[model samples]
Target: MVASIALPRLMRIGAGASRLLPEILGQLGLSRPFVVTDPYLVSSGRTDTLLERLASAGARGTIFSETVPDPTVASVEAALAALKAGDFDCVVGFGGGSPMDTAKAVAVLARHGGHMRDYKAPRLQDEPGLPIVAIPTTAGTGSEATRFTIVTDETSDEKMLCIGLAYLPVAALVDYELTLTKPKRLSADTGIDALTHAIEAYVSRKSNLFSDGLALQAMRLIAPNLRRVWTDPSDRAAREAMMLGATQAGIAFSNASVALVHGMSRPIGAHFHVAHGLSNAMLLPVVTAFSAPAAVARYAACARAM
Candidate 1:
């Protein structure tokens, strides 16, 4: 079977990586980017820091901090309305999966002048909307590099999985330094999410040579570093490794596609408002036990690795 792979055109990985945003945008020739993030980032004043960076780079932007954890179709529309009212030439996503996902959906629906449902799966959205610059503050979800966005539809109350070329980022700034203040709960959940991504990608029916390599490395890096980061939050090297592992897992799942856990987790996220990562964590053991019968070797390997 043929396979496909996609990721950001540019990536900057390291400590103090976020400080390169202005330079990165300049390199990409983007000005006047709309910032799509959450209230926490804004209330915490990381928003201002970003704005200051943009200003420093001679760029201008509108800050849209209204994205919800499970951003709804209504939320997408709200962001689109705001985008239409601005002269944004690019989009910047800063925060966890929620904000990053919101940025992606907004980039698509806003630019294409269509509803979020218009880009639903089994359909490949060929048009690339405004170029996106992702800065992930969490070491999970790997939303920074992937070309897939899991979004919620208010009409059906289902998390619509939008997959294809359009969801990819133009650039991703992965600075583990941003994870410094990540709460232990978020660290645990995101680590599990990354773990799920690696495991599912490894066992996916669509898994291939390229995705397998990425999945293997992701598993190796994430398996050890996840617990380390949890136990010692100040371990800079561990945090950095986890961050990279998450990104690698994102690449793995993006190319290989995720299976049952994601299939079921999306529903719980839509129905119960459990964060996607946490929901995946809750289901990991039970699902592993069930799928173990069918894919015993893969499950056993993961079990031993964990």
Candidate 2:
């Protein structure tokens, strides 16, 4: 059997990875960027700091900070309109999953000119869109490394899972420093999310040798440190491990795909307005208990890895 894999073209990981955005952009030949983020990041001045750094590097950037959690089709449309309003060369996704998802959707819609639902699951958007550079503030979603994005349909109240290479970022800046300030609840939720991703990818029917390696490594990194980071948000070592684990888990699932936990968690998030990671965390234990019987060796491998 053959295994296929895809990942960000460029990745900068570590303490100051986010600070290398300008250089990363320059490497990609992108100067004018449409920066997409959430209001919290903007209000916290992280957005301003990034913009200032971009300016210092002679890269002009425009900011759109209206992205909401569990990004909506309407929000994506608004972001696309903003992207179209400027002469930007690429899209920069700054912050967590929502902003990244918004950027991915806008990038594709800017080139394809269609509704968010048009790119939903089972639709393979192989053609690249505007280049995306993701800077993830949270360690959980791994939106920075994955070739997938999720947006919600307001009209139907359904969470739209958009997949394909087009959604993958051209570059990802994985800086654990950014996650140091994240609250305990968020840390716990996102950690569980990454763990679930690793486990599901390992057990998935689509799992391959390449993805299996990543999944196991992700489990080894995430499981032991998840609690350490949650117990002490300022634990740099734990935070760093969690960040790397999340990205690896994302890469694993992106290549092999997620299984029952994710499939069941999405709707729960859409209907009850639960956080994506939190929903996944809630479903993981039950899903695993039921699934382990069928895949004893795989589950055992996961247990040993964790």
Maximum-lDDT candidate: 2
Cα-lDDT of candidate 1: 0.88
lDDT of 2 by residue, 78-154 (tens): 99988998899999999888999999999999998878888888999979999999999887888898889999998
Q: RMSD for each model, in Å, please?
A: 1.5, 0.8
lDDT of 1 by residue, 1-306 (tens): 778878799999999888888998899898889999999999888989989988987999789999987888888888888888999888899999988988998888767876888788877886888888999999999989888887788778899988767788899999998898889999999999999999999888889889888888888888888888988898999999899999999999998988889899998988888888899988988888888899888777666665
Give the distance in Å from residue 121's predicted Cα in candidate 2 to where it truly belongs. Answer: 1.7
> CA shift at 197, candidate 2, in angstroms?
0.5
**True lDDT of residue 123, candidate 1:** 79
lDDT score at residue 269, model 1, on the 0-100 scale: 84
Write down the RMSD of candidate 2 (Cα, Å).
Answer: 0.8
Give the range where candidate 1 is weakest over 10 consecutive residues by summed lDDT. Answer: 297-306
